[model samples]
Target: MDDERSAVFRFLRTEIFPGGEMPGKHDVLEYSEAGGFSVEEIELLRPHYIRTVDTWAENLRANRERAIAIQSDEVYDRYLRYLTGCAQLFRKGISNVGRFALVK
Candidate 1:
């Protein structure tokens, strides 16, 4: 990821999801195995997340006045930017989302 994209992800991680951890595929696999769970499927969900964020951004724009009223313009704008950045990252493959199915 480029510096700007990394910065955007970092900002989202820190400001929006404080103390949250983004684990890699290997990390997830290892943890699941250690917990005696077998991985049945691992689905890469970047495309889905891209669509999801796009929808969120569109909804935010549609409800801009209400969002700003509920929070502030700054908060609304920040979240909009965060959603936009997330979509971009997912589309460009700079970031990814995943779903894992495990059987214990």
Candidate 2:
């Protein structure tokens, strides 16, 4: 995992998803078990998310003028920064996304 104090992390925490935190797989498993659920499966989706973010960044760039016109230069730049940063983080494995199945 990347340092939480990293510029990208700080920007994301403060601007994009306030109060959001990513928990480790073990943390999720333990929490679920404590709540009387069994972990059925966990599927990592980091690669998919990287692709998704990359596509978003591309689309944002393509529609840069429209985005800025519809929103604001600040908003357009912020989202572009967020999407590109997320894609890089996912590519480097510093961030992860997942799908989980639980049985109660």
Candidate 3:
């Protein structure tokens, strides 16, 4: 539901700040290609992040379509803004995990 959507949304922001908290195992604080999670954790979280993007995109599209039928222009506009903001996450998701690709 909303919680799942929020979880995915936060990961796409590209930086950790403010709350100063993040996901990790065994008392670790962070990870990246150049940081804390180590090779295995990085490999694992990478796929999960991509999957989360795909999930969020599908849900957002579905929700927006439904909203189009009975919602105001503002709702439509907001979703469009959201779509733009999420472009990076979507592109990364598909390139990293989606099987089909179009060459151009």
| Number of the top TM-score candidate | 1
TM-scores for all candidates: the values are 0.91, 0.88, 0.29
Cα RMSDs, all models: 1.3, 1.9, 12.4
Which lDDT tens digits does candidate 2 get at residues 12-96? 8789989997677889988999999998899999989999999999999999999999999999999999999898888888889
**Better candidate by lDDT, 1 or 3:** 1
lDDT of 1 by residue, 1-104 (tens): 58977798689788788899788899999999999999999899998899999999999999999999999999998899889988988888888989999999
TM-score of 2: 0.88
User: Residue 44 of model 3: what lDDT?
Assistant: 30
lDDT of 2: 0.89
RMSD (Cα, Å) of model 3 = 12.4
Q: What does candidate 3's lDDT look like per residue over 1-104, in tens digits?
A: 45644654564443323355544432232333334334332123445554565566567667776777788657665655544445544445422322221222
1 or 3, which is superior by TM-score? Answer: 1
Which runs of model 1 end up more than 4 angstroms from their true locations? none
Query: How much lDDT does each candidate structure score?
Result: 0.90, 0.89, 0.47
Clashes, model 3: 1
Candidate number with greatest lDDT: 1
Candidate 2: give its CA RMSD in angstroms.
1.9
- Model 2 residue pairs with clashes: none
